[model samples]
Target chain A: MFDYLRYIRERNFPHIWCSGCGDGIVLKALIRAVDKLGISRDEMVMVSGIGCSSRTPGYVDINTLHTTHGRAIPFATGVKLANPKLHVIVVTGDGDATAIGGNHYIHAARRNIDLTVLLYNNYIYGMTGGQVSPTTPRGKRASTAPFGNQEPAFNISDLAEAAGASFVARGDVYHAQKLEKLIVKAVQKKGFSVVEILSPCPTAYGRRNRMAHPVKMMEWLRDQTVPVAKWERLSPEEREGKVRTGIIVDVDKVEYTETNDKLIESLKADK
Target chain B: MKKKRADNICMMQGNQACARGAMMAGCRFFAGYPITPSSEIAENLALSMPAVGGRFIQMEDEIGAMGAVIGASLTGLKSMTATSGPGFSLKQENIGYAAMAEVPCVVVNVQRGGPSTGMPTFPAQMDVQQARWGSHGDRGVIALSASSAQETFEQTIRAFNLSEKYMMPVILLVDEVVAHSTEKVVLPDPGGIELFNRKQPTESPGEYLPYRETDDGIPVLARFGTGYRYNVTGLCHDETGFPTNNPEKIEKLIRRLTDKIERHRKDITHCHKIMLEDADVAIFAYGSVARSARRAVFLCREAGIKAGLIEPTVLWPFPSDEVLETAEGVKAFVVAEMNLGQMAREVELASKCRVEVHRLNRVDGRLITPQQVVEKVREAL
Candidate 1:
């Protein structure tokens, strides 16, 4: 029998992502978080949109919904609301989370439902070739933006905090252990939670940019971020080029299904 | 099963009957957004679902509502959503996904006038073609149309049953008039209504393959929890329910999906003919338009004209044989509907051009009246 305690699909090896892709690190962090938290695979569901990062669910031994392009959040929301006994988690890529699925992402956070979203921010639309995405840095080269993109990139964790997520954090592939701790914290929260992990895309993203090698991209990711506590101490000039990577929005509020459960209980009591 | 009597007759609006029928079919989850002509369904569901120990969510948009329904259905709960034309158009992508992934859910489209939001309060059968061919890819769809408040109730339950039986999305197509009208309906006893749930995997968790085709071409469904822990995707997949790139595997999957419905054509197509005894003229129609055609058939009989009516309750997997049988020995056909000859073209093609076809179409957010149908029949004559 397949073991539910160990949250890894042992038989399905040789996953689809290319070598040096940061998706593997993020996947390991997610499994470690769930495993460390003693969450049973039977009680967990991993939903993903169509992207390279979305493929993590297949290698994990959990109920997985690989939904259409940019629809993983709504699909995950349905699973959570339908059966509150289950813990729902979502993994999405830059294009899957911010561009096509932006509405569902923001609305899911705004509703403050109990779903932990592990957003793999790989900068480029790696699944469909190196197309420019909503998070692709302005003046960066992509397949679609041959002359460099003109639009500004989205600060995803900040966007999630603004969208009313109860717990918002940023982690990077450079620090896998720290990322796992953040994921564990997010999953333990009772309301909507989001963790944007800065993952590298050596295939689609690295070849086109100046960080053509995997080490160059890894070094770049390591140099760009600071803890949120230290980030606040820096001057605007110092913070201009740095990203604040830590818990950004954490608060206590009644979750969506809990309120709905109360409504049901009141309705039942009236009868 | 107890016999349904007239004393069981209760006054029910079309949408309310639909909601009640959904509850009877074991639908414990409903996710929807408010849209006219189908809003009462959501309203009634929101009020009644919690009382029945089910959950109801008013999603952020039509697309989310559809997506949620698929998700809930993956958990092996009977789930459904109701929408009108504009909303139904938005749901096309996920409905196609449901078809591809073999997800079982029911979609109720109380069709209204549309190219885009043509009418909010008026009736039209404009989405009949869209219901049949709206989604991308070669997909299987079971779309049922009901004419009255009573049929809308029974057919909705049937829609859920068929959706589970076929493991695909079933569309219950209604119009603004049928969805809004009220009439006395004899509610079926809980024991009398037939409910068909999806076939679950008999094998234990580790040995289960979600999409492994059975002898009947349907796979056993393993719900989201319960340790099955399988993957469900929209891409053309192998028997293991994972995306496949092999051309041969894709061809087999598509052929099986297509033939699963096409091979069961008789069981899926529900149709009826009225006053067709030795008839030479046939009025072919469905949905609310069938009511006008029925009246026109009666009026023609009083005038000593041998007129008949053929209405197919199941719009998709179009009732070709039923129309061909009704068209036998008939010379002219009058297709009456609330669109620009959408179904008329189907009837014409199904009849094999043995009889000439005429359309009495109305797109001004108005239903085709009995008088209008009679005029069209006379013109065809």
Candidate 2:
């Protein structure tokens, strides 16, 4: 437990996250996952894009890059390939991953580039003062969505699965230990793995609505998520307003870098 | 120059020659996406790099390709990527980051016709301006153009040297025709060629600033594992590599980025002045078009027209002084390229005389022939 604390920058603590912001909880989960994996600090590269959740990398004491608004995946992929020994984890937000960087995220997944993407899906663009993001709920009220958001929220896990990601999981920050376990599985996965942690932005998404505190937000998450196995078992009324949580998909596939190296080697030998 | 080794001579396309040049220059990593005219580069690298103890990755896209090159470069490897027009446009942001962060890498733009996806399989030198100013802000660039397969090999080597020396990205401006066209190239042995690795700071990690300039205006870079914990950013940064809003620091940072190349103007600029000694007319060209211009100059000289050929190898920093010096005695300057008057504008800016600068351009996915260039030269005369 204390070892995990050493991986965190206490100076950056009491982070800009609000009192009830679930980003801090998600950060703890990531730290715990890294601790469990026992990967050396120097051998890990953490990349983040611009967002409330993206700030997770700054608080973590690792080889971290705070990149442009939507380029964390490419940066992380670079770090991974440059030194195949380094375990790369990209901490991105819903808006950061699925909006401007949507192309990169899908492509990275499609290549199955042995990266672990921890996407914090807060369902709104919480960093730029609560704009309507690609993952903003269709009728959610955000600063830019005064008349309620018209765009349907992205099912990011589904997108990742479709994009050939080997491992895909979703968990709510309200379920801290569960989120941590899923992250560990993601980190250990051979190919591209994504763990979408549905965290809460109390200051942005919460204050705008009635869920004003961490407790209320946790209650909302608890009410909203249904376990994947039990999803089909639920009645229509019971399934109402629930998002599926838990590992939605896991399949074996050859990773991008390794496959490319093999192909290059064979081609050279033939020549 | 030393005697060429047996392995140096290979009948290959210009793109393949580039790969061989990179290998000779000690480029250990290549990350690129397959785009037309540029695919041969990736194919050659993918086939040859690994055997030479290098690594090649076909990244998700050009954006990822650029990022991978920079990342690999940070680990103390010479790295490069090849792409065409649209992919080049996609890579602008990371290219800007590499510029501001002072990362040494090479970007090879095998030019293709495009406003957007115009001719994927055809040739155009449309990216000349984009190569200089495609990125968001003000920073100087090192660009090289090659007219033949042999020159492609030589210029690619020079691109790596400049990238490492200046700690900036070097652009190899190749076009579709040159990239895909095959020719016999004589590659020099590794021992005979001069390769440049970035100057690492001798100071202690704490005392070092990654972006800090020495008196000569080039920053010293330390590889990532060397325990030098310096920040690299796309934002305007100070000497310590930290983002700063200080007006003076911003001014100095921008000036140093540009001046590092400009101050070494004589050393960085390279061009071939053919038959300019007593010529009354000069034709300025670069890349494959220069090859055609060479033929044109030969025909003009036979016809009793004193036509010279000025082939600029260093396309950026624009060879302004050299162009001005060469244009002194000429009555007219005919700038021939495969695009709409890109290099012609530079010739006009450099010449002190009221010289008539004419442009012979081709955007029809075809090469500007020697006959066309000769006609332009005769008309200008």
Candidate 3:
């Protein structure tokens, strides 16, 4: 853990996150994935839209951009297209990605651009005082929805898959090691990859519900989601509410940057 | 249409000239949406950008297009985007972001009539005010208006150079008339023209601070891939490029961002003055209306009235010094625009209530004619 100190920006530390926050765990899992991949820090470009998760770029030692709300995907697309050598990572929140930046997300996936997006789904807007997000579970309570959330929650992996992502996975912060492995696979993928990290936001969504404590929320995640094999083995009624955590899809496709590169080459050849 | 290397003295539209000028200025990335009057710029870049080892992408929306251009610019490539009123409105958020981040890029707005999608194919100079105060907050803006195809070509290159020089976004503002009109233009040879690239950091990654200011307010920019890993945020940040809530730091940062351009106002201001030396009545105009103002000056001269024109190519910094200097001698001013007295207010401010300012405004999405300007000047006379 001490050897990986170079990846962290210590000067910016004692981060502004709340106590017992799962955002830190997700950040650590990302750091471990990056370290394990052995990619040079200088070659990485981390970009994010506005939110608590977006602050992750500020605390990482890399070429980073903290952009406007729901804008990280398009910004990362520019970086990836301009310099294909630099690996682009997009860190986003549920509201940032699924609600406001939904167009950029689906288009980025449809184009199969080479970007690894780690979506930290705390099921609520932790920053800006706890509003219900697009991924907040149905009937969950938030500041904006004190009675209960009336909107249906999004299946993030399913959204990405439908949008033509080459790699799509869902992980829980409760299983940090396995989450880190999914991030590594996402990083290694050739085209647009999405890894949904079901992070606990005890300060926002959990407190309003029955799981007021961070431990309780973490335990809920552990009990609710099962392994992919076990999930597949269960009957429809038995598997009703369990969220499966693992890589859902992995395949090869021509990345958007390479397609543009080929076009550039041909245009020059014709010239 | 001529694809030859030694092509010159060829007929071209103003939008095509702007696209060529952008190419001449070493812009390698273009991201734009298809919008009326300005769509030709995107069409030209779509075919030409790839041929020159550049990239052109038709993004999902104007905001995304602006976002992509900024992204490409950060990777050390000169990038640009073109749009009309509706598209331009959508791009304001990112344009403000570019201003706050000090990202060097160009945004070309071919003006049209609009409160919201009002007129698409018609000419209007209504965006003159929006160009400066369109984006939120206090920041310096560089906007150039072109009256002809040749001027649009030259101004596009100037826009890119000014953007690179100041490390901020520059706007090449034209109207439907200027954008769609075709004329014979000679693109300057590349050897004869000088281009400026961004200045890079002297130190390596560990020792570098991306927003460290020099004597001039411009900071040394490090592109994404060259290993000077640093942070860029829309939030008020310090020299280390990290967000800071300190009031002192925020004040200093914003002042420097603006002071860098305001201090260089002399170099930034570019205008054309005709017969204003000994004239009592002067017509203030820009973009397509400037053409009508020139003709009005000709008719006024024919009528033996001492009417001159103050036509500004650079509109944002507003050429306040020149306007004030001209206001000293002029008795009354006739301001002509496609909209109702947007820029005339600035003319009044520069005049300091010394000269009588008359506005000849139009909002029917039609070009303000030379006769109308002549009539307005006659009324002022």
On TM-score, the leading prediction is 3
Sorted on DockQ, highest at the top, how do the candidates line up?
3, 1, 2
Q: Worst 10-residue stretch by lDDT in candidate 2 chain B?
A: B224-233
Per-residue CA lDDT of model 1 for B1-381, tens digit only, reads: 987657667999999999999999999999999999899999999989999789899988999999999999997689999999999999999999999898999999998888897898999989998998898888767999999999999999999999999999999999999989999899878998889988877788988998886888887878888888788888888988787889999999999888899988988998878987677789988988899899999998888888898898999989989888777768789999899999999998899998999888899987788889888888888
Per-residue error for B230 in candidate 1, Å, reads 0.8
**In model 2, what is the error at residue A65, expressed in angstroms?**
2.3
TM-score of each: 0.97, 0.90, 0.98
Q: Interface RMSD computed for candidate 2 is what?
A: 2.8
**What tens digits encode model 3's per-residue C-alpha lDDT throughout B138-244?**
89999999999999999999999999989999998999999999888987878898888889887867788888868888988799888898899999999998999
TM-score of chain B of 2: 0.96
lDDT of 2 by residue, A23-94 (tens): 888888888889989887767777777888887776776666667778888777766776677788888999
- Each model's C-alpha lDDT? 0.90, 0.85, 0.91
Supply every candidate's count of residue pairs whose N, Cα or C atoms clash at under 3 angstroms.
0, 0, 0
Better of 1 and 3 by lDDT: 3
* Clashing pairs in model 3, backbone N/Cα/C closer than 3 A: none
DockQ of each: 0.76, 0.37, 0.83
- Per-candidate alpha-carbon RMSD to the true structure: 2.8, 3.5, 2.0
TM-score between candidate 2 and the true structure: 0.90
